[model samples]
Target: MEAHLRVRAALLLSVLALLSLLARSSSQEIQIVNAERRIDLTSHIVKVFLTLKVENIGASPASEILLAFPPTLIDRLALVKAAATVGKRKKKSYLPLDVNPTELPDAPNGTKYFSISLLNPLSAGESATLEVLYILTHSLEPFPAEISQSESQLVYYRDSAIILSPYHIKQQTTFFKTPSTKLESFTKVEPTNRAGTDLKYGPYENHPPYSFSPIIVHFENNNPFAVVEELVREVEISHWGSLQITEHYILKHAGARHKGVFSRVEYQSKPSFSGVPSFKSLLARLPPRVHSVYYRDEIGNISSSHLRTDPRKSELEIEPRYPLFGGWKASFVIGYGLPLQDFLFESPDGRRYLNFSFGCPLVETVVDKLTIKVVLPEGSKDPSAVVPCSVEQHLETKYSYLDIVGRTVVVLEKINVVPEHNSPFQVYYNFNPIFMLAEPLMLVSVFFLLFIASVAYLHVDPSIRK
Candidate 1:
């Protein structure tokens, strides 16, 4: 009996060992041929682009690829787009891609993953290129975090100098582009180069997968980093004559807050105080042929606002009631009018259509949340809209002057929007001609009935006695 039990145990151990060997041999590995990372810090927003060449080296096909970021950046990161292209195609057509976050057991704190699925499974020995674009919000930190009003501001940014990948990297390069050429300080790596406002790092070779090298950059950026916490843009169409646009903004200064009370006398007397970090005014470029421009804040009209118009373009310059220091908040509204001929169209089928476009705010900044509402004429129907960014849409009705039926309102909401989203949003809708003339026809009928009633009353005269 003992001999039989020993034989059974030995057979089970041998089977388990064989299965382990098979699992190890069948495991697949991916190789990164080259990587390029570009970081642009021109405005208040920070943009990052990554491109990679990858190959599947295992026996089986690769259907998915995974990429991760440092735990610290997971909350501040917003993915803009991701795509992939198969081997060396000159025409440059990108494959459809879907990205989602995946949890990693190794990085327990927090790690964001970008998973991309290929249309055609990447067979063994086949290669493809992958590209990723994203934005970093509130990533710039003021080195001091609090500064006096008269001091020049210095901004610091920290990031990885190497590409983060799950596959072995054969070669890689990183480029950091700053807004100004006045770079104060940057970390020096063994293999790096620089020219003008661009700092380049490596064509590094033979790096194990999932490697990281941290870097910090300090530069002179005196520009006010304004962030619009929320913005509401409304467009009201008046088919009778013109189109009106109004925008309300909740703006905030994103730099370091003031440490002490501001001294107006000291600021005026010293030339050095001129370098204080505060937002005084903003310039907005309006569409051509706009009129009736107005700028005001919660307190009332801002008299410091000015409008400049030429044959070529129209500009509006507005000054806030007070200089916006760090952590300070302000709210304001700006409105203008344009002729209807610019946006209305009549189809050959006798269908009336209104097409309108709205662009981003004129201020060079980032908007965390934006809501745009377009109000169409009464009795409008079958409305449609197209916006370049991702948005949630809804429809509502609004009542205004002389309106028998409320106008159709289209509301669009977007999050984490940047200045590059300046692409105009186009909207189209149909209007009934009968509804357009309803108000005029009703007014005429009321007048005609009143005249007839007055004549009848006069014909029936009654005598009065004193």
Candidate 2:
């Protein structure tokens, strides 16, 4: 046993050495010719766009490019997308590429990397321009933590002034666009410039690999930070032509906490200025051709909602009993019905499936915990689910109206959900169409028994005849 352990340790050491060698060799082969980064800080969500010009400097061809992020941002990063440009000027077109997380044994400073696979191998001395869009959530800090209803919200954002890269950058610039011109303070690195609501970092030249310069910006932003602590969506399908959807929400204001008493009179009278950071209403987008929509809570049905329907989609505008301030929370439910033909389809092999949205419908809102349950018809068997991203899934039994053995529920749970997670997922199962007659047959049998009893009672002789 001791000899076996020694052999395993030696093998691990050799593998680590090989990985380190590969990491060093790749960094020397590629270089960033130019880079332009734009960051939008208008709302609670942070969006960054990077346009990179890359060239292969070594003799070998390069098949992928590495993207680096600091340890602080690794968990908060929501989505990253990359696309390569073709043609020039007005004729330019973009081809989407795959982006996946990669690990290196010799990373410096706990750095993380995402590799973007190119369409074709980049030959030596050949250059390509790639555009990447990444999103981050909960990256802003609420300064002073608590404030009165009349006070505007202030936040602090920290990031590196220089772009984090494993390859040397010849020239690069970073630009930031804020919601307003209410700047408090910002770090200046000699050439940093602030004009209106825009801030420019640098057009600096000649930066070595793994360069980083930290900076911070403090500014005033009054946008609402609406966050859903948890959202549970349940979908029930009926072969009789209707699809039912119900969503339960626990929404909270994730901004600075509200201090002192909330004065409703001041908020109502001074709508333009008072309670600038608080939100009174929210909008949800639903699929087109929705019907029987309702918004309610434990108290009763909520009457303060308006729904507009068009050929493309339906919009629901709702208001809670009170405005949501910092640290405040509200609970409610939204239910709707959709035509089965729109979302339910039968495959070539005689299996039925449901294609539905995966996350919350509110605009510009973040959900920390999300649970989706797809309740298939009562007689379904051999269930399966397909989702683009990773999710925890399990099977459950749910009893509904007229169900004998209970319906099969496909439960999917995910955390740290953003708007990018609102994609379609499918649940497939085998179901026989003959089982649709079960409910009708049961009702018919009950009526027939009642009819026979009524006829026998009429024909019975009473005591008067005796």
Candidate 3:
């Protein structure tokens, strides 16, 4: 009984601490809807929706709210739909305009605010919805908008703003992990503005008499935009010995926005010159101890990339062609052969399973379309993959190479995806052994049948010809 009482005391204290945080945070209520869940490797086409919540504790009604959306996100937005309403929602007249959007505000307040939902009167206890959408066009921000060997450059967030409605908002803390040890009860978090780092933890406010979250990040222009433009991975499994992965990748300087133009002259004459960092090249990482690793591209052999794998460290390095400056592009193709044993995982209890990303690249591109063909061994054809398919508009093609009808061809079409969407697109399919042995057996049977027919026909054909 004494121990039980001690446990109860601890629990009660925890709840009290949480309440304290809620009571003290800026605009203590926040609302957000995440759509990253709707992506897959086997099937494509997707939709992302956002919903917001606001609370009204203030006596006077709230006015305009400003927020920034990254230009990358805007360009990559796929089939977007947006709507805004206040308190059970009485629609308000609103407008959209850029801050430095044109020529007036040279202010560091270079942010965008929602002039929508002016005043439909959000009653004392109500929430609102602020909607917006766009595609994920690209990554790789310019290191320095301009270059000068003499000085360092500063980079700020772009398209980053806040969603304001009233005096306070409540969004549960769910995205990142909390630190193991901390002294403060209320931790600080940087709101997701379309800006650079330097985001803060709380007193981050939200709705009611909505005031924007007061925080920003500034840094000396220095992170290189090391990005891969496109990646295509193909795994061919041969029942006999190998699982071959033939991959093609495109490298680019998604950050080619120069202030004026490239200045090699200015670049050469600097004392420890400081300017925006350009993407001169790229690097590709391969899995452990991959044998016969051949790296090439459509143009030919990519001599610039480096490949290395230490049995101890198990690492591989693949580099790019020329130094990628702002606004340049290139492609690469590489292949690796592995043993089938790599895919087989046996459990302590004797169960079997496979964990793989059915041909999904971490960062995708303007993929107009994609077709994935999975080949099983001889006599193995009936394979069933369940779940993890997203918003697929259609799925009809069913065929393959040299197998009676061909293995199944699954195609997924997705656009406006960024580096963040890469992981979720990788899917895990569950299959049994029957489908594993179909390809090889079918090949041998056809070869032998042809040989038998050839022998029987020789005598009759020769006599008829004479």
Candidate 4:
């Protein structure tokens, strides 16, 4: 009877051990209450916005949360901004977050992790909301990857339908916002929702942590995804003349490349061919006070441009010499003049200030690298500048027409800039009135000296004749 009792006791001990292990596993997993993802697809770039409501179901307080990206987009991901708010409050107070990369064995191949540190440690059963914004470059690949000049371009986009979180998700949804409504085909997951140009996927429930559902979308986007490989914008401030703004762009088509040599005959034979995803023309909006404008390419001035001016605003439309195809390049220069009074302000204390904006490109585009050089007037001192975006600034000397002393050139460099960054920058400096008069005085003095020498030479007749 004692032996039988021992066997039963051992079996009960084994069951208890198994239950303990299961409880520990459940406690270690974080719980996601909700996940909302928004993806905006432009020509070549994709912007992702994710908002997650999470709770720490672990036994200990959680200090960091992990965000995982699919293997395809891991290398192209760029974190823009991230923030978090604690609990449900009438007035939400957001806290800045730090994002760093991490790796987990269970994640898919090429997966990258963004570890966000919480401002306050999330106690067990407590929840926090996180908002993350990021960009993915070259995410949309052409369906054929290469097309003829007369073919319509279709792009293929693939991503995980579910948010790759390292936690149990109670509910989740994804919305895809495209530039056009002409969708050719998309993988239809059940319980999908669609409205206008947006495709909403899921209200998925009871998904285990770290699960992934691959989704592929094909859409007809016959639009030029103009990508400025390089941009050099120069802003010259002059006390006498208008503010001269010039931008030189090396523009390239980010869509699929041509399979064979481009045929001008076929392209012209089809009048509808011009509407394909090719870079044909761009329209830029100029400030109302613009005085002069010009557009030219590397070969020479392009005459196929038009300018329309009104009392309030002006527009400059320009077309390239040839339709830009994938992998082909075109370089062009555009410049305009804006009145000084529009940007420059004078204070009673003789302090000068300037406010100006680098307007968007003529078309929807992305700039890989942008360099802005602002040349201040000669002898300007105590210069201070404020730019809307993050930039690398440096001071240089520039010598221009009739400049006695070199001008102060403020060089600002930025990367991964889009057309939406159309905000004005403020620059304050101290300008002496005497400096403004220096150029005029020098010109007058030179002319007077030349006149006197000319008169003296004329008076001295050819005495060699005697």
The candidate scoring highest on lDDT is 2
lDDT of 2 by residue, 145-259 (tens): 9999899999999998899999999999999999999999999986899999999999989999999999999998889899999999999999999999999999999999999
**By summed lDDT, which 10 consecutive residues of candidate 4 come out lowest?**
20-29
User: What TM value does model 4 have?
Assistant: 0.76
Would you list the clashing residue pairs of candidate 1? none
Identify the superior model by lDDT, candidate 3 or candidate 4: 4
Give the lowest summed-lDDT range of ten residues in model 3: 35-44
Residue 227 in model 3: shift from native, Å? 4.4
What is the Cα-based lDDT of residue 443 in candidate 1?
A: 84
- Steric collisions counted per model: 0, 0, 63, 0
Compose the digit string of candidate 3's lDDT tens values, residues 1-466.
9999999999998887766554333233322321111111111122233344444554544442233333234444433333554344355543332222111121124322223333455554554555443233332233455443344434332221233332334432212111122111222345432212222233333223333433223334333443454554555555566777776656554433445554666655642452345544334444555788776767677666566666532334455555445456667777776656766444554443333443334233243233343343334333333323333423333345655644433334443334333332322233456655565677888888998888887745555453
Clashes of 1: 0
Runs in model 1 lying further than 4 Å from the true structure: 1-30, 56-67, 70-75, 82-110, 115-132, 179-203, 263-273, 306-313, 345-359, 445-466
Candidate 4 accuracy as lDDT: 0.80
Instruction: List per-prediction Cα lDDT, in the order shown.
Output: 0.78, 0.93, 0.42, 0.80
What's every prediction's RMSD, in angstroms?
Answer: 7.3, 2.3, 17.5, 10.2
| Comparison by TM-score, 1 against 4, better one | 1
Best by TM-score: 2
Off by over 4 Å in 2: 1-4, 446-466
